[model samples]
Structure formats: structure tokens, C-alpha cells
Target: MSFKYIDVIKELINKIENSQLDVMEKVAQLCAETIIRGNILYFFGTGHSHMISEEPFYRAGGFVPVYPILETSLMLHDGAYKSTLMERVNGLSKILLEQSGATKDDIIFIISNSGRNNVTVEMAIEAKEKGLKVIAITSLIHSKSVKSRHPSGKKLYEIADYVIDNCGVVGDAAVQYENFEQKTGPTSTIAGVLIVNSVISRAVEIILDKGWKPPIFMSSNTDEGDEFNKKILQKYKSRIKLL
Candidate 1:
């Protein structure tokens, strides 16, 4: 049997390498600067997009100063249907940002595949208003095809300081079947995660080049890893609420 999803992801990886290298490096530079300045790097998303926000938080080899703005209502664990409704709600992003304890010195990555939702767009707007740099990870083709759900008449890409296109198709599903009317196998999560990790990994390299030791987590399963991670965790526990 042919694995179509695997092929699709592989194709996306190639596109990312070819088209996104410069922008990814640009974002990495900002990330390295943020770390050197003793600032946090935050990630926010709604619904399934929230998974990308959590991807780097406390992960092995991930940055220690990273935070994910995980609002309960915007996430799917409590109720997926409710989370969808919340993502369209206006004025919620302000509260979410206020509660996340993000400061003007921090940088945020906002992930929304469509980039048209009110909450995500507003989050980008609000973050910029508070003097933080915003990096948007979204599907450009999909966002451009849709109308903005925000009252400001802006999409995430329009409001972000840096936009990293996921290069995904309009509906984000890549596999098509002869008998099926709709495409299956969503690719946004796969593409988005790869983009985020690649940028952060590159940031680590930049930090090293600057002769700074970036705080990174180790796999707890490794010998002595737990001890090392505990110290790192303790250092950021006050700033990173989820830690």
C-alpha cells in the first residue's frame, strides 16, 4: 500500500527548505536576541493549532525560556466544539495575553493555519500593540483565500512582524481520492511543527556562535538528565507559568 501522507510531508519539507530558509534564519536571529536579552519566547494558537504551541515547551533539547499561552477555552481538551466557537470570539485575545504574563521584551509565535480567525488575528494585533514582536506561522494560500474574521479586517499575516508560510494547500489536506469529494490527511500540524523546530534549532546555533550557552532541556530518560533539567526548570519556573 502507498503512504500518501508520508509523500506529502516529504514534499512539504523540500518546499520549506527551498523557500523558507531566509525567513527562518531571520526569525532565528530574533529568537537568539530574545534569549540573550533575558526575555521569554511565547507560542499561542487555538484548537488544533495549540498543539504547535506546546511542542517546544519543556521538551528535550528545547529552550528553557520558552512558554506556551495555553488558554483553556481555546484548547480542545475540555471541549473541541467549544474551542472552535471560542476562537471566533472577539476581545478574548486581550485577556489571554494579559493572563500569560508576557512582557514587551518577549517575542511570540502565533500559529493559525487559516489566519482568518478573530482570536488569532486579534492576538497578533494585541501582541504588537504591547510592543512585542510577532511571528506568524500560517498557510499563506489558505489565509489569502479567506476573509478576515476579526473586526479590524486583518489576518494574522497582515499583523505579524514576520510571516512564515506553511506552504500548505487551501484546506490544509493534501491527499485526494478518486471516489471522495473531500481531501483527507491534514498537513498543517506536520508542516507547522517542522517550521517551528527548525527556527528554534537554528537559534540555538546562533546563540552558540555568539559565545552564549543557551539553556536547553534534556530527555529525562537519559542518565543525569533529570538532575540537569530540574536546575533549568527551577531557573524559569517563576517566569514560565506552565513550567
Candidate 2:
């Protein structure tokens, strides 16, 4: 039996490594600058894309000031189908951004596989209006194939200051079987997590090169991890909600 899903994922990862390295480096530089300026990093997404937003928050080896802009209505747990409708709502992005307490000069990563939804597109616009840098992680193939769902006729990639293609295909599912009507094994989550973690790791290196220690979280499973995490959490608890 062949593992077609794994093979497909490996191919996509290779594409990202070869095609997205330059853009990832630029994003890392922005992250390093934002952290050095005492600004936080915000992440936002809807539906399955929200997983990318939550991936680095409070995660081991993740940055301390990372904030995931989570809205119950936009998540799968509350109502997966409803979240799909909610992400199309025009004004919700502004409300979420305001509630996030994000300020100017911060950086926000907006993940949307399609990149055509109103919420993610508007979120990028709103972040730009607030003087925050917007970095979008989306599938160029998927996004370009569809028209914008935003009133401005702009997709997340069009609005963001930087765009990192997840190198995923349209509809995201990568594995298909003989006689199957629909594909299985989505690639966005895996590709997105890799893209995000790689950039964050590079940002840490950039910070170290600049002579500043990046506030990284240690695994709570390890000895001395709790104490280390507590000190780091205390520093950003006021700024990062859900910390």
C-alpha cells in the first residue's frame, strides 16, 4: 500500500522550501523588528484556517508575545458550518481586531487557504489601517482561481504587506483514490504549521544575531520548564490574552 497523502505533502513541502524561502526571510525580519520594538504578533483565521492561528500560541519553543485572535463563532467547535457563514460577514474583522488590543507597528499573520473570504481580507485591510504589518499565508493557486469575496474586491494576499503561499492546491485536499468522488487528506494545516514555525524559528535566530534574546516558551513536560514559562508568561500576560 502506498502512502499517497504523505507523498503529496512531501512534494508540497519541497515546493515551499524552494519557492518561499525569500518571502519567509522577509517575514522573519519583520517579526524580529516587531519583537525588538516591544510589539506583539497577532494571528487570525476562520474555519480550519484558525488552526494555524492557534498553532504557535503558548506552544513550546514559540514566542511569548504571540496572540491568537480567536472568536468562538468563527471556530469549528462552536459551529463549523456557521463559522463558514460568519467568516463572510463584512464588519466582524474590525470588531475582532479591536478586541485583540493590537496597536500600531505590530505584525499580524492572517491565514486563509482561499484568501478570498471577507473576514480575512478585511482583517488585512484593518491591520494595515492600524499601521500594523500584515503578512498573509495563503494558497496562491486557490486564491487566484477564485474572485475576491470582500467589498473592496481584494483578497488577503492583495491586502497584505507580504504573502507566503502555502503551496497548496485548490480545495486543499491532496490525496485521491480510484473511483473516489472527493479527495481526502487536506494539506493546508500541515503546510501552514510548517511555514509558521519555520518563520518564527528564523525570527529567533535574527533576534539572537541582534544581541537580544527572544522570549521562547519551554516545553512544560520538561523539568524547570514551568518556572521558565511562568517568568515569560508574566511578562506578556497583560498584553497577550488567553496566556
Candidate 3:
């Protein structure tokens, strides 16, 4: 049998539709609370998974005060293979957290499709130790099937305060075809994006329920949009390094 591109889209949409609303709501509530308390929301991941962290950071129509704890050593552009190795090294999470100045009131989002890597797990553990709330976006099936690389023998999902499973398979490739033993289409990225956006939408909803006008970025293209975002930038530029 042959699998077409729409097949992958259908599979991904099904996964998203079936994703646990409770877990996603928990993540959103945490983010909304962080925003209410005027604290930062932090995101961290490694390699391809790091792209998930960048999805909401400093973007138009995105929430303000969201920071991505990006480390070049673990990012692909610098060295893909090197990033993989760096994610396995213990104690790196602490450095990243310290540099970010994450606090108990902050919300930290850690993304790892597989959830087995040492650094992602370690970062969640470290974040909790620092009194920060951690939300993990990972594959429950994948993490359960794989052994943890961390010394604690715990996966990212186990360490985070809120665990929102991407509901993907172990290897994350969803489409299969005859004569191809290994699947071709990887669905984790799109599924993850959907989950993250859902969480953000829910967070905004919760904030509005509380009668607070949450600070969200506006598009840079429009005149009012530019003015609105510029003020937000001027207010947070000192606190946010990337702003």
C-alpha cells in the first residue's frame, strides 16, 4: 500500500483532536498564572525539538514575556551531531536555568518529542528544584518504551508539573508504505505546534476570564500593530534579552 501526503495530515489532525484537554488546560493555567504574576514564561528544548520553543517567543500575535532558553551548543545550526551529544551531558540544564534567571513564579516549557534525552529530563528536574513550574510536551508512548538517559532514570514527562503528550509513536514517523520498512513522514513537529497553540489559546481564554487584558504582541506590518508592539518592546526590552 502507498501513503499520500494527506494521509499524514489526517493522522496528525486525529492526534491533535484526541489530545488530552485536561493536560493542555493545566499547562495553560500555569502560563496564565505566570502572566498574572508578571513573571516570565520560559521554553527550552534541544535539536529539532528546540524549534517548538521558538514558536511563541517574540513573535507577532504571540504573548509577551515568553523567553526561549536557547543554547547554541544544543541547537542544530551550530552542529547537529554536536547538539545531540550536548543534550546528553549532565549539569548543562543548571547553567541554562541560571542564565535565564527563572523563578518559582515562572513557567518553563520543555519540549522533547522522544522525552528520553538526559538534558531535557534534567532540565525539568532542575526547574522544579528551582521552584519553577515545568510543562513538558513529549510523546508518552515514546518515553514509556525507552529507557531514561538521566541518572535519575526519569523522563521529561515524569519530571514536569504538566505533561501534555504529543500522542505520537516512538520514532514519530506516522506514514508507512509498502517496500519501506522505515516510515517517511514525521508528524511530531506539526502535532506539537498544534498542541502549543492550543495551550496558548486556552491561556488567553483564562486570562480574559479573570478580566485582565493580557499583553500580546501585534503584527509589525500594521500601523497600530507596530505602535502597540513597540510599547511592549520598550517596556520589556530591558528584561528580555532577545527583545
Candidate 4:
């Protein structure tokens, strides 16, 4: 591999390691408090970043109160596939927020690699206006260096109340390891995993500090599925409504 790749990866680790723990603490506090207050946590992402949104759901030790605001409905899942031009012309952010039943007490986590897409930006705006605290996971270096496609020229960082910079390049590749001519995949996958783990760990701490057992889910594949399912459901009984 090239020295450029090595250097970038090292830099990313340093940035995250040196990050202010205050942000994670705040997020955990918000999440625990919101759930305790009977509000939901909404997560949204576009394209590849959608994987990040799925990381925390239905996993062992995962929260049950998260709403992934991706349109899984057959009619609006993909605008490009829509038969009607009007359906394709619609602003997806509004629909997502409306369907999720977002409110002032809800928290939103938005994952965007570029932090420049119209849908993600609009969701951040809508959530913010509705009094939601939005957390953004995106690449700072990439977003700053690249020209945004948002018409208002606003990027993800501009809209988020808390910004978590995922260490990666514009193409999310560190260097040309596989092909000596071009850069390959960078640390986005690593960043996504790290962010989710950190969120969960800190959330556990906050929950414990509040004298409550953390409401974490266990895999349905587990032998203790019934017990775990009961625990998770009881923990999140009134906060989450799954369709």
C-alpha cells in the first residue's frame, strides 16, 4: 500500500481518539432522557450510509426505540422507480418526518458521507424546526473540499446541532492499495462502526447513572430469545411503535 493511505488512516484514528467526549455524553443523555420521556429516536441516511442507520436496530444489546426514516413503502422507496412524475418530484424529507411522527422531544441522527444531499439536508432542517436535536455523522474533510449540490449551498454541518466527523476522503478511499493508480475504500466503514459502538457504550453509562437498566435487545437467533424479547419490549413498551 501507499504511504498516503497509511498517513490518512493514522490521522483519522487520532481525530477520533482526541474527540471531545462531551458530544457523545450529550447524545447519550438526550437519548436516554427522550426515551424515558416517551419520545422516539429517529435515524436517517441516504444510499450507503443507510447501513449505518441499520447498525443499531435488531441487534444484540441494541435500542428498540429507534425509527429508521427510510421509505420502505413500495410506492416511495425509490423515486427513480416511481411510475408517476409527481411522486418522483415530491420532497422525500417531508414524507419521512411525517410518517415517523417526529416531534420536539424526538432525537434524530443523520448519516451522510458527503453531507450535501438535498433530502438529508431538508430532513435536518425539518427536524430542527420541529425542535429536534439532530446529530450528524459525515466526513468533514470531504464536505469542506467538495462543492455541495444543495441549492441553498448549505451542507450537513451547517444544519446539525452536533457533528461527528467520519474520517474518510471524498471518495471514502485511503489509497490505491488494490490498484496502484487509484485510491480504494477508506475508513468510512470503520467510522460507522466506531460511531455506533460509542453511542451504545455511552448510552449504557447514562442509563446506569440514571439508576435504570439499559434497555438493550438480544438477537432473536439467541437461545434466550423469549426472555430477551420480553425484556426489550417491557423496556420500550410505550416509547416505540413499530409498523
* Per-model RMSD to reference: 0.8, 0.9, 1.7, 4.1
The number of residue pairs in model 4 that clash at the backbone is 3
Question: Candidate 1, residue 112: CA error in Å?
Answer: 0.3
TM per candidate: 0.98, 0.98, 0.95, 0.83
Model 4 spans with C-alpha error above 4 angstroms: 1-11, 72-90, 177-179, 234-243
Residue 33 Cα positional deviation in candidate 2, in Å, after optimal superposition: 1.0
Q: Lowest-scoring 10 consecutive residues by lDDT in candidate 3? A: 1-10
Against the true structure, candidate 2 reaches a TM-score of 0.98
Candidate 2: deviation at residue 112, Å?
0.2
Q: lDDT tens string, model 1, 86-176? A: 9999999999899988989999999999999999999999999999999999999999999998998999999999999999999999999
Q: Which segments of candidate 2 are over 4 A away from where they belong?
A: none
Candidate 3 residue lDDT tens string, 15-95: 666767877877788889889888888899899888889999877767898899999999989988999899899999988
- Ten contiguous residues with the weakest lDDT in model 2: 232-241
Question: Global CA lDDT of candidate 4, please?
Answer: 0.74
Summarize candidate 4's per-residue lDDT along 86-106 as a digit string, tens digits. Answer: 222237787778777788988
Poorly placed runs, candidate 1 (over 4 Å): none
Clashing pairs in 2: none
- TM for candidate 4 is 0.83
Top candidate on lDDT is 1
